[model samples]
Target: MKILVVDDDPNILELVSIQLNQAGYTVQKATNGFQAMELLEEELPDLAIVDVMMPGMDGYTLTRKIRAYADIPVLLLTAKGELEDKEKGFLAGSDDYVVKPFEPKELLYRINAILRRYDKAVDVFIQAGPLKINRQSYEVSVGKKVLLLPLKEFELLSVLASKVNTVFTRDMLIERIWGYDYEGDEQTLNVHIKRVRGKLENLTGEVTIATVRGVGYKLEVASI
Candidate 1:
């Protein structure tokens, strides 16, 4: 696996690169976000380890830029460990956030987890009512119509559709979709659910995302 490491601090950048190399990953080093984007154009890496504070473009902006095109997982490595900082990192599309001065072992663990979670399934597809979700292709369809959804929305739908009428708690959904260490609040989950619900409504009436009173949500398929 190739990992792009971006940081303004040469020592820290070198440190991360060495760690990644020692772990059997090819390392691409960039001092700033602009350089990172340039490197991305040359060849996209499997994952990116970005520093939050940089000269021209911060990690958050760089993360957004990467998400605009590539679907690779991103891990934000920075000194900002506050709740709001972590939330911002996630909002910007980072797969995980690790505070600076982090342990090399933990960093590798998080990277592995993110990659595993994002890896495409071999042969998994779900059929709920009129909708068909293909995990391998990351495609959602109803009848002859295909819906292009954002990654998070697709993942949320996929999980719910996997078990029709199964209620998944907000915490459970958040942990499954987002990382367990995700610092974002329930509002983030709710917003994604709302967006997914709206998209599903447009696609099919037979399939619905039902909100349990105090529990969570369930995907319901109307009987034919």
Candidate 2:
């Protein structure tokens, strides 16, 4: 597997490359997000490990930009270990996140987990009653028509729809969707949820993405 590792720090770039190479994967290095973008244009890597802090473009912007075209799995690296940072990464588009000073084995394990998750079947179109979610296609439809959605909206809905009625704490949502280093933007999650709810209002009357008061949100499956 060809893995692209993006980090501004030379030590991290060298160390991560060495570790991935030792693990028997081909490694590519990018010192910043722009360099990573250039590499991406030339080679579509199997996986990407990106740092949150960079010179030209930050990890979140890079993730968002790349996610526009490809859904190739992404693992984020950040020194800022906060729920908000984790949420930001998820909102920007990331598969997983890890903190700085992390164990190489742990990072390897997270990569394995991400790859395994991809191996499992996740139907893009999850239809139940009036709602349908296209996980791979990133489209959502209700009743007879399909609605356009932004990347964050689609990703947030995808996470919620995967398991109905399961309440996700803000932190879990951040970790599962945004990645670990994600910064605060519950408001980001809130806005997208509100937008998704508005789109589904005709079918369900109210929001299918349920807010748990002070906690987080859940996907309320409508019974037919």
Q: Model 2, 1-224: lDDT tens per residue? A: 57899999999999999987765557889998888989999989878999999977999999998888677888999999889999999999899999999998788768756854763354546765567777767667776677768776776777677657767666556655666566777676677778878767755653377778877788886564
Model 1: which residue pairs collide?
A: none
The candidate 2 region of ten consecutive residues with least summed lDDT is 115-124
lDDT of every predicted structure (CA atoms):
0.86, 0.78
Off by over 4 Å in 2: 122-224
TM-score of 1: 0.55
* Candidate 1: tens digits of C-alpha lDDT, residues 1-224: 57899999999998888987765568899999999999999998889999999988999999999999798999998897899999999999999989988997778778767865765442277888889998878889998999988999998898788768877667557766886678989999899999999998899899999999777899999898
Global fold similarity of model 2 (TM-score) = 0.54
* The candidate that achieves the highest TM-score relative to the unseen native structure: 1
Q: What C-alpha lDDT, on a 0 to 100 scale, does residue 163 get in candidate 2?
A: 59
